[model samples]
Target chain A: MIWPFITRSLGIATILLLAAIGELLDERAGVLNVGIEGLMLFGGAAGFLAALKWGLLAGFIVGTIVGGAFGLLHAVLSITLKVNQVVSGMGIWLFAMGFVTYWADRYSGPLPMGMVSPSIHGLSPMFFIALAILFAIWFILSRTHLGLKIRSVGEDPSTAEVSGVNVVKIRYLCTTIGGLLGGLAGAFLTLTYLACWSHLPTMGLGWVALALVQFSIWRPPILLAGALLFGFIWQFAISPETIYAGIPAPLPVLRMLPFAVTIIFLTVISSERFRKKWALAKPAALGQPYIKE
Target chain B: MIGLRFPKLKCERIVILTGADAVKISALSVVISFMLFGAFVAFEGTDPLVAYEHIFSFAFDPKLGLPITLHRGFFLVFNTLAFIIPMAAGIWNIGMEGQFYLGTIGAFAVAYSFPDLNQAILIPLMLISGAIFGAAYGALAGFLKGKMNVNEVVVTIMLNNIAFWLVYLLTVGGPWAGIAESTSKPLPKNACAPMVWNTPFTSIFVIVVAILVYFFLKKTTIGYQIRTLGSNPIVAKHVGISAPKISVIVMAIGGAIAGLSGYHMWAGDPAFLMIPRPEAYKAIGDLTYWGIILGLICLLNPLTSVPASIFIGSIIVGTTVLVRRLRMPFGLDVLFLGIISLVFAAFQFFHQYRIRRVKVVIGK
Candidate 1:
């Protein structure tokens, strides 16, 4: 039973882990992609459509491209145009929700048969792909010169610019990469996990990914633990039948477990005593639009 | 004999605009947004002008649209105000949706628990309870942010999901479940506030409250302190203002206003307390985002938020009409809103800077 739970948790965590890692990268580069919610939804729709017509790999590629397009929009608005980051992020989210919903309504047909069957040892191949991506990101961020440049841009763009770093280019690149990951997460959900298209198939998982970034304090290893923790809680809440069939907990209460636990964890980690004991790993320039003077 | 001559360099300057120029820029941005949206509508194979006509007619028609528009506006005024107050204190109270839900639950609990109370007594009791519940909800986030250093954004988002589930459980098959299975029983007759001149009496109440909030923010010392804190928390703290207390106070006030909006939903126009269907709940939750946009448009001023709320309210009503009458897709309003807000944000950038090109020879 415990083994099954671990496996289920990993399967669910794949989507979140990928998205959170992407968000972590974006935030490290001082861009908060709140539109992850919408990006994921759009990715899900695009992936579903592409998967139906061509194949899963094509779906994933198209979904990543779509997500990247929105990320570019955000980068333009927040970095080049110097609009407020929060508003731009929210705009992307809202636009994605509307666009995807519209597309699904007009163009979608019946689900392709056998979409729900597991394709790789009782799990989707995307799980291994996600693990590979995670290790790659960790290597890039921790071991590469480009990673250092991205971090410098996020920490202080003006200083980075003085040191000959192209802040705008780095930010745009990071944001687009973040969007690619978010898009892949959405595709993973529809093409692998749930195996079908639904309105807002990402649900509120995008927001949860945002929270996980903070919970992990922008570190890859900690992020992995956070994602798995949240994924476990989420699966447990929604699939209580798998754990204990006879206990009659209210559905709403069960559904709320993940969010409630998030609140509790946030309160604990945010305590003044906790901060005193361990330094908070927030990016110095997170969420601020850089303007060259 | 060797003389070197240098060519003048071409320079570009960015000028910050002010006063009337800023207003003109903003107006232009609004026009651009409308044109962009019109183009989008045309792309959908509908005549933009015709679509606009249908939208306005459904929103402004006295017999069909005015009452609903006004009803939505009444609630939106409170919701927008709820956002504005905390925003004035430099806090993004994204949890307003949750507070609103809790407020409705609070009001419903009062009305349900004491079904025989007189309107005069029950209404005030319900309002106070609703406000208190909302305040407490807001204060929890405030406390975590102030005392615990939590990011209010994540805390509020999490709280929103929790609040929503709690409400869902209570209303759907729980103790407060009504005969409808998805809604609580209607408030007792006497407990219901009578409609005034074919609209909700709460409309008048909302107007009065809006006025009071405007004065409170404009005239009071605490209000001044809040604005000062928002602009520069460090400076405010240097002058001995307590940051934690102010955070809690502002959030509580915002929560109370949102709670009043929830109360209005329960006892106002369609005077019944129902848990929205899942899709409806998602749409309703998006209302907080709309309120944020309104608050930003109004620059966090209560005086301006009223008109902003009304404007947004009409758009919402118009969009619903478009979907129902014209068979448009369900989420067009949200798309349009996103575009409009994005344009507005861009306009805000333009308001701050103007591009000027200077002619100069370059090569030396």
Candidate 2:
């Protein structure tokens, strides 16, 4: 049970970190991708099906492409048309719910379950993929010129534009990249976590990842730590063996630890007086929609 | 137009002022939502005719369908009040699920302790006790938010999980253990509210409660304050209103209403008093969220919730009839409703903002 706990925690953390990191990028580029869950579902189905046809690499590539397309739709509606971000995100969710269920039912034979795309080391191949992607994202978001430009767009799009940063293009690219990461997260869920195609399979993970951003305060490094903590709470709370093993508390109550932590984090940070004093690091234009002047 | 136009004014910020056109917008929204919902149903690969028939059979037929549907409807209505009131106060009381459970547990505890209590005393006491239990649970979240600035959404969601476990722990350990499942003992007969309509779902308690709640919202100072706070807390504070205090009160009231809703469920359908099967799920009167959705469809107007619940109730009834008659799937009804909600939410945006792409003829 403990081993299973450790493994599950590791898997959950990986997926959560991927999604959170994607969201962080989008937020940093002044676009809030609230429809991460939808993109993930679409990605999961596309990637899973692609893996069955071609291979894992093909699956990953297909997932990224599909995800990029959805991101483009988001960017066009939000960045270009200037629709309300929240509503557009919700529209994306509705559209995905319709598309994925229909697609999953129509295409494919038996859905994949139990194992991820072929293993690299003792760990599932996804573990290595996640590690490589995380490092790549960290480097791209922090050290590179493009990363600086993206960050400045979120911080002050007007200033970034004045600096000849082509804010719209950078925002469009970052949002698409965010979608690609979101797709990878979903693909990992199907190919690694649950290892199956499911209806609303992502459950509430997308929303949870959004909350995780607040928990980590948008820092990529802290996102990893936050994901691990959340995963630990989730794993501990649902382990039936731990519940029956003379543990002083019921398991369901413990399952609540992640939510409690989120509430505490939000509460501590959102307090007016506290916020006014030493402000927590937050994406300047987190949920705001971009309207080019 | 009643020969009326905008009054001459220096400065006005009236965007979407109320008129008969508002009704047209809402009516259009409902139509659009239903169309979208129908498209989703078709995509699910079931003949919706069959599905709609099943729901109707369940809602109106004198058999298992009507009784259960009515029972569910009453509880849903009861829960909606609990949810909407707090929402009006600008607090998304997602903890209604927990509060409902607490209310049910509290009602059961009281009834079980004094089985011989007179019906006159027992019924009112059960309702009050349930309300108190719910209020207490809701107050915890409110207090946390007011004192700690904790986001209500996160706290309420967590509280719901806590409520689920709390019920599990208590029923497993305490005297509410059912004869079959280890849930609460059967609710005493004397504690049950008297029936108004000869139907299973229509209870005198539900109707009386609805009226009281309506009056409480429209004709009361607390209700006014809650509405004011919900609209703008900063303005409310400037006008010497304590936003936190109103929040606490509104949440408590919301919880109490929700608790009463749970109590109604117990009285209406004592069968649910038992714990769930090998899977440890408990309803504890969860018809609230759907009721709230229906309530929102009616523009969150309390008066509208009544007819909306019945109309939505009819749809549920209609769908059940379709299910058995047409051999459609069972859970597809909910999916249809969800699609409807999504459509309704989307259409609401369009209704609020009308887009007109026009060319600017500067030279002309």
Question: Best by TM-score, which number?
Answer: 1
Q: Which ten residues in a row have the lowest lDDT in candidate 2 chain A?
A: A114-123
Q: How many backbone clashes does candidate 2 have?
A: 23
What lDDT tens digits, residue by residue, belong to model 1 across residues B33-119?
A: 779888878887788899888877887788877777777777888888888888888888888888988888888888889989888
What are the DockQ scores of the candidates, in order? 0.62, 0.26
Steric clashes per prediction: 0, 23
lDDT by candidate, in order shown: 0.79, 0.68
Candidate 1 wrongly placed segments (more than 4 Å): A1-7, A53-55, A105-110, A116-118, A276-280, B1-26, B271-273, B357-364
Cα-based lDDT at residue B222, candidate 1: 92
Model 2: lDDT equals: 0.68
Docking class of 1: medium
The numbered model that scores best in lDDT is 1
Chain A TM-scores, all candidates? Answer: 0.93, 0.86
A1-293 in candidate 2: lDDT tens per residue? 46666777777787887788888888888898767877888788888788777866777788878877887877876776555566566557656655575566445344454334554332355655666776787798789988899888888888788899998898888888888888888877776676666555775567678777765666778788888887777767667464257777665567656666676766776677656542446667655655555
Q: How displaced is residue B247 in candidate 2, in Å?
A: 2.2
